[model samples]
Target: MKLELGDQSGRTAIITGANSGLGAQTATALADAGADVVLACRNTDKAAAVANRIGAKARVEKLDLADLQSVRDFADRIDGANLLINNAGVMALPLRRTADGFEMQFGTNHLGHFALTLLMLDKVSDRVVTLSSGMHSLGRLDFDDLNWENRRYRRWRAYGDSKLANLMFAKELARRLEASESSLVSVAAHPGYASTDLQGHTESLMDVVMAVGNSVAAQSAADGAMPTLYAATSPAVRTGGFYGPTKFGGMRGAPGPSSYREVADDEAQRTRLWQASEELVGITSPV
Candidate 1:
């Protein structure tokens, strides 16, 4: 079924990484739908440009998900919001660490969003949407080696692990909110092979390969952002549902309920990841 969002007047949404790509598209779409949009980004200049294009309905806020302190500060600054889209993320890169010294992908993609969602949970009146990826099927988390400290680090595998964490975090958060009898819902979505700048940043020859793949197989960033927008705004969305492209092996198509790996449904792993994330970010029992 094609999903179209209704008028969102009186709703406020905060989208991370709103400077470009899917985040930008989602922010623009939501603002056009009459929701107040906050472009929470690391680069104020780029975010400002987007906000300008979005006119008065959009504003910019500086946020660096790689830095836990930045996440805390941003959470503190926002009074309240109806929706929070945890859309900012880093893909495959050389073994690097976040400001808090965790693996960059896992730190920014999962932990940072984890902390931000918890810190801002009380203030959010509606739902939380997190961006995951199709690559999450390839992820296998080793709690002991989550940071790649005990073994060799493969950039793609690390990225997969982070995306998997994003999916599990959403599910676990949904469970907690339900258990706590809160109205808030948590959901996740993936951009199936969308052409975006995320592929151009590997700083390696894979960039060339991905560029070719983008030109040949990927959909537009706006199309990729649809699943996220659907998750964020669709009244039909379930608390823990995952949406994505529903055709061509989930590589590109209209947004819908998409398939996920069996591993993603592991309740034990979801609980463990949530616990581990809480310890890593120094937060507890957020829901």
Candidate 2:
């Protein structure tokens, strides 16, 4: 049940938010496999520390997923890569807005990656891997109020919607890539209950709750990242496929096919979300 990575000497991979947690674990694993790794993160200092540890094969780049300009700027500097992992995200938090004035979670988790992937599509020669969540099943998208502008804002629900959007975006991108006859593939993965800094940003009592949960019920960030690495590099992965841990209800174990909410498979919704995302991000779909 172990996931083995073959020679990746010729590959280049860009991973967002690689300063810590699952992103850092994924970056280290790939670099160890001989891939050139780019830690595309907002915090250059932390990312630099990670790159330094990975030695000459890794480099740090500034990428703030909360701002579109940052996303664009990050994409502009990337000449090419074999993989682009849309791995950065925020979890449940009090209502907030991005620089573009979109809901913080939805904006950063989905639209930000949306714009970056499209902007860098031509530069990515192999695949795009997006991170989703087991919590996606609890999400119900109100496209009309995606930004939480007209509704009661619930932090957990907002997080769920964003993660659901992540899954939807990956599948839609895969469909468009196939239709365009492109070699690039899009796949999705989830960490299940990974213990990471991501859960500490809630800025509320839940932070303490999640911290306790992490100590008691979560897997290590390295183990949690296995699904992402498997999706990014595994030949067994299919376009639009989702992967996660195979044991303890998909929370921790070997990587394998993972179940997603049925709503995530709705074709019409996927297309509609894609169209709306394009309009929101002001980018035409390259696929």
Candidate 3:
């Protein structure tokens, strides 16, 4: 089923990772719906290519999610953003740290977007959509060692943790928005399993198997982008809602309410994570 995003005229949408994959597809849909899109990416050149294909309604900007300074700089330049899609991320990379020396997946996937969203809260008028994953089911909160500073880093576990954090962040952000009595909403969505270059970085044998499956059975990036666009544009979507595919354990289908591990809904953990994230990112609640 195709996503129907109605008029978004004169509004601006900032989408991270828009140079390719789901982000690019989401940007295309929004631009077609009349929203001016800003592709926030680490490489302006690659993003520019995506922008060219998107035509006049889409533009490019430098945004490195691994670097806090880059987030700050990018937020500084933008005045108003009607939609902020925190869609950029790294999956299971070996053992790499962000520029801020935090665990790569957790830092880039969770904290970077956390900082960016908080910093841009004043400019955002409508919604914030963060991309999570079904792998979040494998995750648990490790409050004492979020950065993996002392723990032995298991790449997949770390990735799961980061995606879990994405959901928690969205829920907490939604709560805060309510507290602040703001009209803006925070939502989360997972693309399920989409065929995209996002899988190219991992070298595990499982990666090879998954790549084969993706080539044979996975949904296209455009289909994978549906849930995110649905959460972003659908009036039926509520604050703190999480969306994904409706079939095959949420691996593929049209957009709907997605299942998440019960642990992800822990209110206390969400609060703790919010506090820890603010501490790690060196700030208080933007709300």
Candidate 4:
């Protein structure tokens, strides 16, 4: 069946980092679906513009996933949401700590979204979709150095770790939902090499490499967002499913069932990671 996001009249969605990149495109598509989207972003001004462009039904809400208090505040503001798109994220950036003192990439990419997802679980009814990446294939969880404090930090490695965590979290959350007998669904989607500001965030050397590759291999932000929108709204999507591009190696094509990282299927890691995340974020959801 075609994954169409139309006729979502009274449904509401909260998209983290919805001001730009895949997030912005997803917000626009969801608005087109007739959903009232909350553009949860760090930059209010940029988010406002995105909401304005999407239509007046879109609302801008300030959200910095890096801070627990900010996550709490954002969660509190939500009354009920039909969809929660964990679409906002940070990329390969230099070593920096978030407001909560976690490494920047892991903090913004994984933990921030982790905390937000848990905080908003009760508020969300139908589904939650997390944005992961293909780099997840190369990653292994470093439980010994979860924060990269003792080990030497590299940008791409940290990014891969976070992306891997995203998939793991999505899967684990699905399992938890099943155990709790909750109807809420959790799924993951990735934009394979999409052209977005993430490339601009890279170092100059890597930027040039990405810039060249992007011109040929990357899809536009709107195309990149299709899988996410599909996962969020498609009737055919099953809980715990992953979706992405359907072309060669999933680079670009119509949204479809996507391959997953083998590591994400490790039951032990999924359990351990879930417990650790719950402890770290200090929130326990029936899931």
lDDT score, candidate 4, position 143 = 88
Q: What digit string (tens of lDDT, one per residue) describes model 3 on residues 202-257?
A: 77886898789889998999999999999999999999889999999899998999
Tens-place lDDT per residue, model 1, 5-107, is 8999899999999999999999999999999999999999999999999999999999999999999999988998999999998899999999999999999
Candidate 4, residues 61-172: lDDT per residue as tens digits? 9899888899889888778799999998887888888887888888888888998888888889999999999888767778878788999988889988999999999988
TM-score for each predicted model, relative to the true structure: 0.98, 0.98, 0.98, 0.96
- Model 3 scores a C-alpha lDDT of 0.92
Q: Please state the error at residue 215 of candidate 2 in Å.
A: 0.8
**Model 2: per-residue lDDT, tens digit, 1-287?**
34688999999999999999999999999999999999999999999999999899999999999999998888887899999999999999789999999999999999999999999999999999999999998789998998999999999999999999999999989998999999999999999899999999988999999999999999999999999999999999999999999999999999999998988889999999999999998899877
Residue 6 lDDT (model 4): 70
With candidate 2 superimposed using the best TM-score fit, by how many Å does residue 19's alpha carbon deviate from the native?
Answer: 0.6
Residue 45 shift from truth in candidate 1, angstroms: 0.8
Query: Model 4: runs farther than 4 Å from truth?
Result: 1-3
Relative to the true structure, candidate 3 reaches a TM of 0.98
State the number of backbone clashes in model 1: 0
Q: Worst 10-residue stretch by lDDT in candidate 4?
A: 1-10
How much does each candidate deviate from the true structure in C-alpha RMSD?
A: 1.2, 0.9, 1.0, 1.6
